[model samples]
Target: MKYSIISILLSLITLFFSIKINLETLIDYLSTDGKSQAFHGLIELKYLYKYYFLILSFLSSLFLVFAFKINELKPFKHSAAFILILGIVSVFTAFWKWFI
Candidate 1:
């Protein structure tokens, strides 16, 4: 139960950070001039956010596995798994954006 609660808290924190970074990137993108063609700046931000997403994914996965193994947080097990999956998808999307 304790571990599950801790994992949930950590997942929430990771989510908060992820949202913050995404908003910052969006704001930067919107503020820039389309005619300026600031591709380089976007590329840099993409990489930066990609790594941040990766970190979130890692932390989420770690806690998710722990929660699964302990099997004590039955009520929250599914929620934790969902967060882990979402984090992974975000990481992949970030990487895809960087590559493309």
Candidate 2:
């Protein structure tokens, strides 16, 4: 019960950060002149953010696993998993933007 609540809270926090990163990315993209390596660099950064979020989410899953298996520290595992999934999706979207 406690673990579930904690997971939800952590997930919310992770979501907040994810959105923050996205907004910042958008602002950065808009601020840049649409030309040259700067564009590429921004795209790359976007890709990187996806990967980073995915990893963090995965880590959150691991935290949940640890909480369950260890029976102590269970608060963050599910949150991590959720974040990982979100990151995976974000990456996919970014790839689509890049390729098409």
Candidate 3:
């Protein structure tokens, strides 16, 4: 319960930052002949991080819903299980990145 709340809170924080980041700077980075390639590359990396964070956050919300509906085992249970597993795997993948 507490972990879910903290996860949601952190996901929301990441989402907020993700939405605020500018995409044009990232687009510019992908342009091979751009003047600010180095700086723009850094910005692009941040942009990707922001987007992945947002995706993870989104997935986390789905996992929360799955967790909430875990007991029913009627209609949403299968979906919930699938989502729950997916969430676990995703978090593991994210952890690997963090650790490495």
**For model 1, how does the per-residue alpha-carbon lDDT over 6-98 read when each residue is reduced to its tens digit?**
667666766666656665566555566765445745544554644565665666667667878877757787877676666556544533224
- By TM-score, is 2 or 3 better? 2
Clashes per model (N, Cα, C within 3 A): 0, 7, 0
Off by over 4 Å in 2: 36-38, 41-43, 46-56, 59-100
Quote the lDDT for 13 in model 3.
56
Query: RMSD of each candidate?
Result: 4.4, 5.5, 9.0
**Most accurate candidate by TM-score:** 1
Candidate lDDT (C-alpha), each = 0.61, 0.53, 0.48
lDDT of 3 by residue, 14-77 (tens): 5444434543443444554646764654545644544455466566666566546544433344
> Candidate 2's residue-wise lDDT over 1-100, tens digit each?
4554454555555566666666666665665565843555546564364445555555556556656765654335555456556654654453322322
- In model 3, the worst 10-residue window by lDDT is 91-100
Model 1: pairs clashing at backbone N, Cα or C within 3 Å: none
Those runs of model 3 whose alpha carbons end farther than 4 Å from true positions after fitting are 23-46, 70-100
